[model samples]
Every structure is written in C-alpha cells, then in structure tokens.
Target: MKFAIAVFSPAHAPSSRRALLFAQAALAGGHEIVRLFFYQDGVHSASANVVAPQDELDVAGQWRSFITEHQLDAVVCIAAALRRGVLNAEEAQRYQRPAVNLPAPWELSGLGQLHEGAQSADRLMCFGGD
Candidate 1:
C-alpha cells in the first residue's frame, strides 16, 4: 500500500509518536510512504533548531533520519512553519530572524503538496487529528 501521512501534533506528544510508529509499521509491512506532510505544530518536528532536554530524545532528528533513510518525501507547510518561527535559511534571512533552523531532509512547501500526495497515494492517513 502507498500512504500519505499528514501529522498535526507537536513533537513529543503521544499522538505524534504513535503516528511515527504507525508509519514505521506500515513501511515494515511493505507499505510505501508517498509523502509525509507536517503542518501546524508538527512542522516543529522538521525544524533543525529544536533541542530537546537531556532526558528527552530528539524526535525531529528521528524523523529526519527515517525519512532520509527511506527516501520518503517529507514536506512542511510554509505558512504553518513561518507562523511558528520555523524558517529555512532564505526565510530566516528575509525575516531577519536570529537563525535558520529548518534544514535538509525536510523541504518547505505548501499544503498543495499534501493534496498532491493524497491524489497519488492509495491511503491518506491524518495523524494526531490532522
């Protein structure tokens, strides 16, 4: 099965973790991820500037590695990301933010990417309630 996974919850949330786990299971079961769109607070999961506390694992890092390893399309909603101060280098320079956080393995894109993924994928799974 081909899947398009859309995540909306913040990283470290149980729902978000469950979503990733589900994606892993799907992949292990011979399913393919056509796309993984991160919107709302979920965009933070693709932000490179995020630093979890010493006790917490880096969920974003985990996703980055997973997506890259699997060669899955990982995209973030630009509007949602900018709204939360998650900016790529160009955006950060344009906005004069202190730093550029979002990086490779996570592409900044529009919601249309999600729609395209849905159109192409066999199943569209919305995680953490979209």
Candidate 2:
C-alpha cells in the first residue's frame, strides 16, 4: 500500500503521535509512504524551535529522524510553516533570518504537493481534526 498522510494537529496532540505510529506501522508492513504532509498546527512539527519538556523527548525531532532515515517524502505546508516561523535554509536567507534549522526530510511546499501525493498514493490518509 501507498500512503499520503496529512497531519494537522500539534506534535503534543495524541492524534499527531497516532499518525506517526500509523505511518511507522505501514512502513513496517512494507508499504510505501508517498508523502507526509504537515499542515495548520501540524507544521509546528517541522519547526526546529520546538522544545519538548525536560521529562519528554522531542517528538518533532523523532519525526525528523524517522523521515530522514527512511528517505521518505516529508512536506510541510509552506504558508503554514512561514506563519509559524518554520523556514528552510533558502527561506531563512530570503527572510533574513540568522539561521535555518527546520526539520529534516521535510520540504516547504504548497497544497499542490499534497494533492499530488493523494493522486500518487493508493490511499489518502488524513490525521487531522476540525
């Protein structure tokens, strides 16, 4: 199976973790992940500024490592990321930021990427809330 998962909740949200776990399970079952699209509050997962409490590990960092290690297509909504101050190196330079440290294996893009992912994947999974 191929999956294009859209995660719209924050990293701390249980739904966000559920989405990640689902993806991991899918991959373990030998499925392909066409794309992992983060939108709305979910884009925060792609921000390097995310700081987890001392008692907990950084879920966003885990996500980054997972995606990068798997070499999967991970994308964060450009508009959402920008609004939340998540920028790539080029974006940081363009925005005149001092540094850029957005999550790895994630790219900033428009909704078209999500649409394309849906079309490319066998299933379009939405891990989001109203």
Candidate 3:
C-alpha cells in the first residue's frame, strides 16, 4: 500500500520514533511512501541544529538518514517551521535570521502539500498532535 505520513511531534517524542519505524517497515514490505509531512513540533526533525543528548537516541539523525537513503519526499510545514524557528537558507535570509537550521532532502511547503499527499496516497497515517 502507498502511504502518506503526517508527523506532528518533536523528534524526542515517542510518536516520532514510531512514525519512523512504521515508514521503515512499510518500505521493507515493498510499499511506497507518497510523502512524509512534518508539522507543528515535528518540524524539529528537519532542523540541522537538533542535537540529541549523549544518552538519548538521535531520532532526528536517523530520520535524516532514512529519508536521504530512500530518496523520499519529506516536507516540513512552512508556517509551522517558521513559528518554531526552523528555517531553510532562503527563509532565513528572507526573515533576516542569523542561521539556517533546515537543510536539503527536506522541503518547506504549505499545508497544501499534506493535503495533496493525503489525496494521492491510498492511506494517510498521522502521528502525534493534541
């Protein structure tokens, strides 16, 4: 089955890890991922500045590697990311920020991307959120 995943938690959250594992299992099962949308606190997963504690698992790093290796379509919500200070180069420059925390392999887009993903995929799996 093709799936579109929407993650709304931070990388340190358990739901974030579960989302990653689910994606991995789906791919291993020969399923396709239509897209991975990171919203709200989940935008932190796409930030290059995320540094896990020494004793903690680097879920953000794992997410980066997984998405890069799979060449998946990973998107971070623009409004959510901006609200949380997760910025790409262009956005940082546009906003006059001192640094850029978001990098390649992750695209910054509006919530419309998530809507599109859900529309295209056979299933839409959302993780985390109030």
Best by TM-score: 3
Q: What is the C-alpha lDDT profile of model 3 across 1-130, one tens digit per residue? A: 8999999999989999999999999999999999999999999988889899999999999999999999999999999999899999999999999999899899999999999999999999999953
Question: 1-130, model 1: which lDDT tens digit per residue?
Answer: 8999999987777667777899999999999999999999998888887777889877877888888898889999999999999999889899899988888878899999999999999999988743
Predictions in order: lDDT: 0.88, 0.87, 0.95
Instruction: Order the candidates by lDDT, highest first.
Output: 3, 1, 2
Error of 2 at 32 (Å): 0.8
My TM-score estimates for the predictions, one after another, are: 0.93, 0.92, 0.97
Question: lDDT by residue for model 2 over 14-130, one digit each (tens)?
Answer: 788888899999999999999999999999777777889989867787788889899989989999988878889989989898877684678899999999999999999988663
TM-score of 3: 0.97
Poorly placed runs, candidate 1 (over 4 Å): none
RMSD of each: 1.6, 1.6, 1.1
How many Å off is the CA of 53 in candidate 3?
Answer: 1.1
For model 1, what is the alpha-carbon lDDT of residue 90? 88
| Best-to-worst TM-score order | 3, 1, 2
What local lDDT does model 3 show for residue 127?
A: 94
State the RMSD for candidate 2. Answer: 1.6
